[model samples]
Target: MRALGPLALAVLVMLPRLTSAQFGLLDDGLTVQTGREVHGRWASVLHLIPETGRFFPAYWLTYSVIWSVVGTRPLAFFVVNAAVLASLLAMLAHLVRLAGDTRVAVTIAAVAFALSGPAVESFYTLSKAEPLQLAWIALSLLCTATAAARARGSLGRAGWTAGAGVALLFAHATKETSVVLAPIALGWLVIERRAKPGHPCAARFAASYLGVAIVSAAAFAVLRWRYAALPLGEGWYTRAYAFDAATVGPALFRIMAWLVRDFAFLLPLVAVGLVRDRTRGPLLYASIWMLGWLAVYLPWPATFEYYLLPFTLGAAWVAGIVVGDLWRDRAVTPLAWPTLTACALLWVSAGINAAADARVQLVVDRANGQLVDVLGGLPRDSRVALNMSPINEYHFELPMHLVEMKRRPDIAFVRPTTAPGHQGETFLVTPEMANPPRPTVRIALHEAAVRQDRAMLDGLIASGAAERVYETTQRVGILEFGIGRLLCRVAVAPILDPTYCPTERGLIERRTFTYGWQVHRLVHARPIAATMRHGG
Candidate 1:
């Protein structure tokens, strides 16, 4: 406990930096855009738009406050995200302490939760509501535990119970998925009170919690119905999975595999803690909290890694309790070596995951920053037709860039139309343009895009429709972990052209990851030219 505060603080400082490496906003661009629009305007903030789905007032409110302070600075959002993560970790520590675990166990669990791979992704992205939802869920759990310990009919018990309900409401307001927590909490209460038949305090507390949950859920539903109209059809992203006979088997397999991979490191610790601890209440509660979320998300067609943020926290807590128990045991048992070995392996796994994440973050940050610069240079009113790959580094569409760059609303920035005879005075932006007009307009292209579409580039050059205007190369030295001199030497090869590799082949080959915004202008001949040629 004494060292817990410092450890948490250290993690708090480190989390934002790790997640903030990417330059542009990720998926949460819409929320930020809406928040900016509705800041200080209460009426608009309360109404949920059809595009964003259910009302997430808490998410909107937090967005308003943070955007108000930081404006468009990406680092500011990262800092705020880190702060939320810190608060979540603090609440988790408190929950573990309430569960009667030793200080050693509490610290281990909190650290593990902080280091969770899925949690790292969630916090790193900074745009999702999962982090905020997790924070509120932790607060709700702590409040529920506090209420369970208090005397029936006492003011303290009532206050804690009320607080728990409020926290649950905030959680629901943060994310619709939080409704699952209510039943899990109720089940926990039932299990805890089963031994004491006719226990008035237990029964009263359970009833009060249930009542609050039901009222909260009903009120939210009514508000959503009255204010937020559901979309007639779910988006392609959401409909990527649905309750289909064909997909159910695969979805189940994926869900099972994900659970196993993510929690394998923590399961042993949880098992040991459950066996050694006198009270199984905390372990059971955490397990149910995790399982409840799994049951809800697994059936849904569109569950991603970030969706598992809450589940990761529960597993961490369980592991922490077990580790703490092992530390407290005075006897040297046959299992001691095995347990120590597993813990060591878990730490190694966490380190490797963090390193890999860091590498990708570095690459994405470099790429997006360059892309923003290129797009920013274009005329504000240019009718830019973007032909970006569907699965780019950031998984962004036009909306993300428009929101981040604060482009003029009147500007016609759109995806390239597939329709024939779609000719106009447009600035064509693509990774590799085939059959571009002679003396092709040159623009910076992302190296990854160019490499992936190398054949297209070759075709354009061979047809004399494309020619390099000028090559601009940048060296990202930070990407070079070691053996820098060799990498720099290899960067000079012509096989790695300047469009994709502006610098030495070794240093710039794979190390260089950016969007190449190759600018091209379509050439259209006058109608009179065709008539004169036919007459001649």
Candidate 2:
């Protein structure tokens, strides 16, 4: 049982790879632009607070640090986020042990968190505030627990407990959802103190944490009042689906079904933990942790599955407590079937998630890689015209900066409609122009930019300036198409006309929408398009 703890950790470090796909454009692209182009410093990043209505100073600072060290390499950022995941697991494991669970329970719980499907986005995305806040909240608990159970003197205990308060402040700095963490941690402390009844050190420890929570709360309220003025409890994304008010009730019901489907695997363990022992056990802490976050998610409009990552800590502890309870109970003998069943269920759910990842994870990665190779191979001092959507820019640009920007082999990259006074031995980079309506021509997308892009591509082809050197079709994965359909059913998502592109299907990843990707490069340009100037 003792050795099980280390083995579970070994598995956790490897399990995160299960959800790895290259970063999407919105978060990853914005993050990359910060480092490679848009001043990556904290001063430049903070300007976004008023515009975006989000105050994520800590999240930006982490990226600035990554940019300072790795210089825009996505892999380096991934490694750092993986370390955050590990720290998160370490804190959860410590919490479970403090709750009096056996090593077997801690081991199972740690492994479950590493493989959680609903928590994948936090692990996979380059920019997210959710994971950071969870780590901060857990660190607070670790500090408080260490102070209460191990520190001997009042001064020593308060010193250790002060660290917990700092952790809570960090959590509030990271995400809006963190408003729930303080009450959960503080409530559990108060409950524990009630059970013990007037130990001087316990009273001191609880008072310190409560004071920290209050200070953090008052500071956070100021930040919220100044910024984050968006009121989104009415399920704002539902407006995108274009549902009638009369039909909204059923649509919301379907969304609830989807959320339940995504969360079903962990639900049972959390339920059992709450029901089994909420009086003075680990179950009580787990209940507060789970219920607290559930309250926040209820009003917040973003119902995406990845948003559930904040609940991973509570879910993990609940699994450990409930399973540990079953493991220690000798009354249900026969080699502990209940404990074995719970473990099997966790693995089975993980298997299902892994299968789903395999189906859709590689689509963007394949296209992004091809785009890099095409751009990387361009001759030095040559001018190239490139046109694609902003989301595609994210998929294509991060690697461009990391792998190609340093070299670009001295080649010039530009939009299809080159500006005045720009002339060179130029080539046009395009995607499946032979097939229309191209993504650039979609009305829902920016109209003026796409029209200029379309005219340039056509003029180049008609003038015989474009000589096709490399071409490949990138199709949207079946799973991506299915997710779009699910979104449509959950709320009457607009059906994009086939006139927009060859494929009727579309998908949204972190609010960056895409139809599909296809790469077609025209080499040995005659400079006619580059020399020609078009007015906007």
Per-model TM-score on C-alpha atoms = 0.76, 0.67
Q: Write the per-residue lDDT of candidate 2 for residues 91-149, one digit (tens) a residue.
A: 77887777667887787678667666545545655577777888887788778767876
Global lDDT scores for all candidate models: 0.57, 0.55
Winner by lDDT: 1
**Deviating ranges (above 4 Å) for candidate 1:** 1-25, 51-53, 194-211, 231-241, 277-279, 330-332, 389-400, 403-411, 414-454, 464-536
Mind giving the per-residue lDDT tens digits that candidate 1 earns over 1-536? 55457355646646546554543435455656765787778577666565645567877777777877887767777777777777877787777776578878777877777766566566666567888888876776677667867876889978987787788788888887787866976886776577456445445555666666776677767666676645423533344435554445444444454454445566566656567644355577677878888877754653455777888888878777767766666366566568757866756544344444444444444555565555555555555544444344333434455545556454465443222344434444445322111111112234445554454435444654444432223322222211122222344332112222223334212233232245554232222121111110
Off by over 4 Å in 2: 1-24, 33-49, 150-153, 183-210, 220-259, 278-281, 298-301, 330-343, 376-468, 471-516, 521-536
Cα RMSD (Å) between model 2 and the true structure?
8.2
